[model samples]
Target: MPDFLLSQLLVSVTLIIECGAMQLKNKNYILAALSVSCFFNGFHYLLLEQPTAGYIFLFSSIRFLISIKWKFQWISAASLCVSLIITVSTYIGILSIIGFFATIFITIGSFSKNDRFLRLMMITGGSVWLLHNLLLWTPVGILVEVIFVGSSCIGYYRYYVAHKPSEP
Candidate 1:
């Protein structure tokens, strides 16, 4: 199969997996699903020749899985530091900056115990990634980010907003 075709296939799988994560109310399950999605997305970016995004996505897969079992502040700090190192080492151009910031937001959110905050950070990171995808002209990537943001928002609303106690 052609690289482009394979890249599309990878990202499409990522999109499906990530979309499933949005509906998950359990933090650990969400993290697990995201880890799988990130793994696939890493390969997709690599095939597109975007090393910065690719490496960050690959690292994120491990980070998300680790966060599911450990919510230590040190872990979050180390993840951020490692993300910076990856971004710097794989520096492609201005686009890499976007992926780095997205990774930072995602890493912090992933380490938190609050599911609402996690979804919020996912939305923020996904929005930033939207720009990166646009710049790269990856239609599947752009679609994934858009769906990620929308699904995250819906999840947030369903769990946080809709269920909030009525202040009397």
Candidate 2:
């Protein structure tokens, strides 16, 4: 299989299945899909010498359903920590580390109510984009990447701070 095929299939299947199950009472499927997708994506990336940031995004989502839950927080923290380490490794010239950490952190922050994580994401994103520029010797990709990261970070902030809770 192609390196990305498994992860791509997992994500597509997840989107399809989840959308079909929107009215069901059991939400375990959503969590399970996310977890499995993250696990596969992360594991695949690791196998292919890629950053495990996709795992961070999917695995760290328990914080959304509840606040400070044990499994969710620990997993999120672990993924976040891994992502950060990957970020550091990326800067240090790890050829395999593809800055997935920044992407995953932003994904997680975008899903949560945590402004702190959002800010952390923006900083991490900007920092990594700058590092990419430093390494690539080109400014072309930097603007697009920075804007993407910035936009996602800002969207999360705006949503969390400006929106009313649907319930609870």
Candidate 3:
């Protein structure tokens, strides 16, 4: 495990680069994003016999930043999928397809003003990322991840129905 100081430093750096995590005004969101980055970086450096997997987090972060900086949602979406797959491939010996589902949800959610749906997608993606983390080293993490995703799914479905256009 990374020392508390190192993790705090990493979180601080990520918060600064992501503009104090302004896009994610909620502190929880910022913490989640930074923590995910930390997990990937830590995994690559501490575990993993080869250590090439850490770059996946960097690529994903860059892609995420580009979307916010340049407003390229598609690029961000693609990068998210790529990063998810890279991380999952390294850890999981089996396929779960959570990345694919999350990406599709994100891509669809990105083109609209459905903030609720977008949040759901982000939460779902985050949950999957957590699950992937658990699958890699700690099997107990999946239960928590599932609860988080499930709660968000309810909100998402509600928004999807509310925003849905009606027939003529």
Residue-pair clashes, model 2 = 0
Superposition TM-score, candidate 3 onto the true structure:
0.45
lDDT digits (tens) for residues 62-84 of candidate 3: 54434443436666566656756
Question: What shift in Å separates residue 73 of candidate 2 from its native position after superposition?
Answer: 6.5
- The residue-by-residue lDDT of candidate 1 on 1-168, one tens digit each, is 988889999999999997778898788999999999999999999999999999999999999999999999899999999999989998989989999998888898999887777888889989999999999989999999999999999988987788883421
Any residue pairs clashing in model 3, and if so which?
Answer: none
Native-referenced Cα lDDT, model 2: 0.44
- TM, every model: 0.96, 0.37, 0.45
- The collision pairs in model 2 are none
For model 2, state the Cα shift of residue 5 in Å: 4.8
How does each model score on lDDT? 0.91, 0.44, 0.46
Segments of candidate 2 deviating more than 4 angstroms: 1-29, 44-49, 52-79, 90-168
Candidates sorted on TM-score, descending: 1, 3, 2
* Candidate closer to the true structure by TM-score (higher is better), 2 or 3: 3
How do the residues 65-118 of candidate 2 rate in per-residue lDDT, one tens digit apiece? Answer: 332233355555665666566466544343225455455554454344444454
The true-structure Cα RMSD of candidate 2 reads: 8.2
